[model samples]
Target: MPRYDYRCRACGDTFEVSRPMSEASESASCPKGHADTVKLLSTVAVTSRGGAVPPSPAGGGGGCCGGGCGC
Candidate 1:
């Protein structure tokens, strides 16, 4: 499930809803029962599951100067 943010123009409040991605485009009612709401643009942050990424290899990583072509 994914969460989406929405702003209620009539009540001047913001709320969140959790639903399937297929229904993400559907309108959401505010918590105050206001039907006049607009979906808000949200940002997503991605991270590695291990909490850290592997370091890059030496020799500048593979183009022509990775010590294979002697550059």
Candidate 2:
């Protein structure tokens, strides 16, 4: 299941839902009785190996250290 962010166009309320991807389009509504809610594109945080990997520097090679350091 993936968490999705939504915004209520009728009530200006924002909320999150955790469900299967197939349910996203059908489960869009505001808890405040607003039916004009829409899904909002949002960013999600991801961690691997119990650590967060930082983004690579711009204009650098495809390596983690930005270049070959032989570390």
Candidate 3:
């Protein structure tokens, strides 16, 4: 199941709901029983289970294609 955040336009209430991916697009009701709600554009941050995130290849100190280009 995936969790979704929704905000009610009528009551200005915010809530979260968990449902199957297939029903993710379905309308969510607010705590005040308002069906006129909209899904919020939320951000999800994923971190590696192995602690620190791996550095980007482009961020490598100073080697261009393994020093072949000698840049």
| lDDT tens digits, residue span 1-71, model 1 | 89999999998999899999999999999899889999999999888779777777666667686656786
Ranking of models by lDDT: 1, 3, 2
| Colliding residue pairs in candidate 1 | none
For each candidate in turn, the TM-score is 0.65, 0.57, 0.67
Error of 2 at 9 (Å): 1.0
Which candidate, 2 or 3, has the higher TM-score? 3
Q: Which scores greater on TM-score, model 1 or model 2?
A: 1
List of clashing residue pairs for candidate 2: none
lDDT of 3 at 14: 89
Best-fitting candidate, scored by TM-score: 3
- Per-residue error for 11 in candidate 1, Å, reads 1.4
Better of 1 and 3 by TM-score: 3
Could you give candidate 2's per-residue lDDT for residues 1-71 as a string of tens digits? 78898899877889988989778677676888778877888887766886776766664675656666654
Best candidate per lDDT, number? 1
**Per-prediction CA RMSD (Å):** 3.8, 6.4, 4.2
